[model samples]
Target: MENVSVLEERKDFILYKQNGCSGNGMRCDANSVSGAVSQRACVYCGARVVLNPITDAFHIVHGPIGCASYTWDIRGSLSSGEDLYRNSFSTDLRESDIIFGGEKRLTAAIEEIATKHQPKLIFVYATCIVGVIGDDVDAVCKTMSKKYQIRVIPVKSPGFSGNKSVGYKMACNAIMELIKSEKPAKRKGVNILGDFNLAGEMWIIKDYLKRIGISVISGFTGDSNYENLLESPAATLNVVQCAGSSTYLANRMEEEMGIPFIKVSFFGIEDTTSSLIRIAEALQDEEARQKAIAFTKEETSKITPLVERYKKNLTGKKAAIYVGGGFKAISLIRQFDFLGVETVVVGTQTGKKEDYDIIESLVSKDTVILDDANPAELEKFMKEKQADILVGGVKERPLAYKLGIAFCDHNHERKHPLSGFDGMINFVKEINGSINNPVWKYMEESL
Candidate 1:
């Protein structure tokens, strides 16, 4: 509220100073303002991104072809074995089908996918059109599940009903429903939640935990299959990496299956070490704790010297962060700090009050914090703060380049890992390369 010059209607959503605020630091967890050109994706998109990482599941969009095409292979979530999730299936509902109800089209699509692919699981996503047409998506799924003796789940996500956060909830609910009927033998390992395994990041975390004598029973969706998910309730604990999308599922599992969960982030050196220690402590395994301590000590010694070199080169540079979740934004701030980079602007599409509070505490007094920011707001604040670089997803890439600022891919589109110790090295390398590129000299001269 420190008199930041954003649009009048968006004043409540942007904050320059937290101490002077009477209530919460920034307004968040609300629908994007009308005509704000908010960067948040639709409800169906949110659900699809969260659930589309299941490697073996057949995902069918029960709407027009556009909806399916818009999010085809949306996440960079990689699979080790099956890659059937890479294919985007649609009912291809036409105007005639919309008038007569697209339930038949949806059923036919499911039947074709099941028969040809022989998939064990199928997810039918209800888009805005399906929601409007009153298609009985759930009933169709139930009938198909009975007929094929496979799990045909219905994900209720209408783009017009709510924002992306609501779609995340819908995805979690579908996951819960998927695992409800199973009763697998309990495993002594843990379930890793919220990570979509972009660039095999989940695999890196799994390796770290394995080195510390911890077993990962399954990932929430990333690189996970139907069989693995059926065993989720059997895990001893749920370790959440992306809290925005997976916290609700973890809460439900804890409430019903007595499986406790701990939120952990593995984005930077500090957070990776801390998360390893926390996970070891949560499991109450003495051997694992000692191994984790030794491994972190050795890894830090090897990585710190390399990181210090980058810190020297990146000193005094400032970065603006706009990401899908608060957890990632907070991690990026810490990561930039590791490289001696100042974070001048930060925001998220689905961050809660607690996430924003942590972010506010971490940033400098002059840092601009906003929620569900539009491109105009982002550009204004980035220029005002004089950010040298911007770390965001695909949507923000053009904006950063248009401003002649360096841009780093930190979201689903990236093919590189940025989650563990190795990922930290890759992240700094990319940041250094982009920021120090000689092309900026020409850009500056032209400007």
Candidate 2:
């Protein structure tokens, strides 16, 4: 048999050539090449992805309308409190506002919003334009905080200054500020970090915890509000999911509040079960562990048939993956196996070395892995590798479709919950649906 490798010609990517194409460093990081449409989003996007799930707080985008328009309610964070945060409140800075200064308009917007909504908190997100215009968002927020007698925090999330990781830091700073305002409450409950209740995934996991007799203090951003967040220190433990977005916050919380956190994943069957068990064990309670066992058994049994059926149809298919975090890339390698699919090419925007190691261990010897991959690299790899489908976010979706390949929505914008036992079934259904589409036949013919 021939060595069927998919090495391409003339691309700036280094991941595939060095360090064995595992979703980690050696391929890319914060360094951006001139004029490249890198698959990674801006810093504001990163911060927005992390914080937009707070649900109740008034989140105002302090920039031109585009930033607000692009990120309006983009995450799957479910709202259990006031839905005011979901509203897109952009300063809509026009050319004139940019020149004279946006401080006055921003002040009016804040006062108007405060008078109308009387929200518990208001978060002003600075965008690329705001950073450029030098708007004094902090000063304005401070003044408004006094006038409204509410917490008004300013998030510095400029798009071009750095990549999304910087935004994560900005969001964490805002969250930390929110934590500082209230007294810490000690309780049996724990904080679930990075589990935005997208499609109610947080709600689903919360239910499982409740079934195991565990109380939840709050989620990091998903379905979270100001009051619950301040009480995060009261929780006994923190379960960190989506570590790329929440680990910094968790570490900060641990350092400041004497709370410990554990890394967890709730995507695939294996990850979800393991996460439940890990959380139970972290609490160090016998009753919780036993209840977790029973809960896991029941959910596993219920999901087996669905996984099996999807496995039958999706087995032996080839997939190209592009995602945001290393944890997801790692979990997805396992998820693909459950459906009998092989990941030929996999990559992420911000996967660490440890994550790459896990991805390398999961895949076949010749699989392609990449970090901070651009559209050009992805297109080159997918086409050359003969992958049938691609799994990625909105930016990559259109590119994948343009090349006549199938895609899955694994990003924050997805409407459905892809967590828990039911999520396992939905995962199967989504994968199977894409793999079995009749459009592939047409694509093959055109190719």
Candidate 3:
């Protein structure tokens, strides 16, 4: 028999070792191994992903075109207002600017964007080059704000400084400053934090909350605009998802605005039911509690059958999961369990220690669990683990396809929402299509 083993692999220890993580013992928060094509994006990416859901805000990139180009409308946050947030704007920094300075170009670009869009606010983001060139974005934003009488917020998200979580904190800081500009009001509502409204996921959650008689003041950035964010301080409570990203915003809102925050997830049926109940219970409104129960019952019936059908097809297939946050990985493990699939390999880019604690417990022994994995590592581990399908974001998708393995996209770029009742069904369909495709037969024949 010809060696039927492209799957046979050497154990790349740094790439494969799940335990004895070097960073855990050492000062590991250093720039990731250079030239590894690390899946973790730049600091600007971290900041932008957290803030770009503000549909009316002009999210101007005050740096090279690459930064904006890579992230342009990559998320699926549905907007209820102006769609200005969808377009990516850049100073389009050139070689001359890199050697000289990009400040003037940035100022002109902002002025031009303002003239064209007349946006209520403009968030000017700084990149690695801008950080090095030392463009006074704050000074420029202040001058522009005064001249146009608009809010020009400067985001200090230099790519090299740290990771995506740091950028998320930066986004939260910008929102805090904006909320401070408006007068506070008594809140009859809560803000949904960390939901980017991808394919109307935020809307589904908002509808559920509304039916339960709880006023969702506004989603942090999902379908959110300047006016909605201005009212964020008024919300009595904050329910945060994707804690790796938005937990900072919720914490700051609580400290500065007197609004308490609760961590929640609305992924699988179990998580969605618990989260809905928790939010309703926190309100202490009986009507909300009753409404949540009805929503849960209705959705469970709708989704359970769909899950069962997929489970029947997906029963024995194993999966490899590499996501951005540990919370997502945690939820995915549960979701895979619901589908009767085993997760053979799992990892995250910006997961916390406590998050690792939860994930480690959920996974089986010898299941490779790593942190801040690069392409080489992901490729090696996925093959070594003999995973049938790989679930990850844009960067990881191609690798999976190249290897002739099935893939599921569970990232910001997805057009469909993967939250609540509808999401569960959609998730099933997507996975099923990929796993049981006619193309796989061709791939098998080629193999």
Candidate with maximal lDDT: 1
lDDT (tens digit, per residue) of candidate 2 on 1-447: 023232342133444423444443354455456566667788998888888878787788889889999888777677866776677898889999889999998999899999988888888988888889899899999999998899899999989889887888899989988885566658787899988888888889889899999999888888887777878878899998887888889888889887899998888888988888888888898898888888899889988987887788888899998999988888888899877899999998877677777777788766777777778778878887888889999889998888888888988879888888878888788888887899888888978
Candidate 3 Cα errors over 4 Å, as ranges: 1-30
* Top TM-score hit: 1
Give a tens-digit lDDT track for model 3, residues 301-347. 97677688778899988899999887899999999988888898888
Per-residue lDDT of candidate 1, residues 141-213 (tens digit): 9999999999999999999999999999999999999897678889789999999999999999999999999
**After superposition, which runs of candidate 1 have C-alpha atoms over 4 Å from their true positions?**
1-5, 18-23
After superposition on all C-alphas, the RMSD of every candidate to the true structure, in Å, is 1.4, 3.1, 4.0
**Model 3, C-alpha of 202: deviation from truth (Å):** 1.0
Q: 26 in model 1: Cα distance from truth in Å?
A: 1.7
TM-score of 3: 0.92
